[model samples]
Target: MTVRSLYLAPVTAVFPAPARTGQGGAAVYEQQRNRTSDADDSAARADRVVELLGARDEVELALKASLGGLPRERDETLARMAEVLQATAQGLALDAAAVWADMPERVLRNWLAKDPAFAAALRSAEALAGAHGLAAGPATTPTPAMVRVAVLALSRGATWPQAVAVAGFPVRGFRRLSQTHPVLAALVEAARRARPRKPKNFVPAGYRPRRPGQAPPGPRAFRLVRREDQVLP
Candidate 1:
């Protein structure tokens, strides 16, 4: 086959252009092609977003499973403390978890300070949670300070890796934290919605880069400037 025939054969077989009744028919075909292309691009973007969300959910479930069980206690108050410890291990705040367990926040604090067995239980809970990638120590939630740092970095246009580095937190930990704290998730969404700023010296295509200390070229007003004897004033 000829070069022109070879080129047109595959394209015609794939697209199968409609019979040309007039210019309007061709215009309609073009519009349909453009619409189909746009729809496909939108679908691809949506799929990527869904995949990211699914990955985050998987990470959270894995972390929860790794946390194991809370220490058993005999007394009612100690049982309540165990409940609080479980809640906190799942990334809830200390006071919120205490309230969730139907215990007063002040009373929980008093128990931790005055009771030796309770303190020892607290230590055991911390070790268990920490072994499973949860935050340990006095703070209850999973790396609230690191989450704050990451949020701030993300707000300033940093990407996930950069934000995680700045926060000095693991990616899985950050994702897990976001699952518990709706406010942190909302802040991250807002940061994503914020438009990225372009560089100050951006230039369009067909333009040469300007030298340092030189001003930018102005807009073209005259089309005939390229023609012979058409001198720019």
Candidate 2:
């Protein structure tokens, strides 16, 4: 089974809420979670996703195993593998992010060696991911990788464009990188210390800094209710 087939189903699973009836005191039911894939099947799928994420490290060897015999005859596998990796990244949160976090340059290069689509996508993705990784930094003029990473961070509310302030870039490069790189940029953005922020309309005009052990506001919450008569017969 494809890695995409395994993890993506969960993301689409909406957070369930208590179902309410519209009229006539009808029974209400929450939307059901997909159970077609059993626990055993899910465990198996998770294992496969882990394997593929690791395979990215030895992409050449894995590609050789998947389509080595076909070589030029089989080009679709490259796209298939890339698609799986991308799906795992977007759908599965912890596992997918962890898998990619460990992905290094050496492993990616190894994978790119065997397949042409991977070779091309890797080159593009590398430029994007790498540039993004760099852009997550404090650099003003960064490599394409940084720009890609920045866009990804911006997409997720992690970082702001004004921080880097690159106004002009060519469309040929296809900064679609933002859609791809957020999972990593978030980490980089989080590491940066938050600048000392000024209080914004928070404290009142006469707001006074309370000293330790000082009196504080009280009665934030109160009850207004009455109990019905429960006299026993």
Candidate with top lDDT is 1
Candidate 1 Cα errors over 4 Å, as ranges: 1-75, 91-93, 136-233
Model 1 pairs whose backbones collide: none
Question: What are the models' TM-scores?
Answer: 0.28, 0.19
- Give the total clashing residue pairs for model 2: 9
Q: Residues 141-191, candidate 2: write the lDDT tens digits.
A: 434433333333332233343323321223322233334555333322332
Candidate 2, after superposition: displacement of residue 48 in Å? 5.6
Candidate 2 lDDT trough over 10 residues, lowest sum: 90-99
Candidate 2: deviation at residue 86, Å? 15
Q: How many residue pairs clash in each candidate?
A: 0, 9
- Looking at model 1, which ten-residue stretch has the lowest summed lDDT? 1-10
How far in Å is the alpha carbon of 7 misplaced in model 2?
15
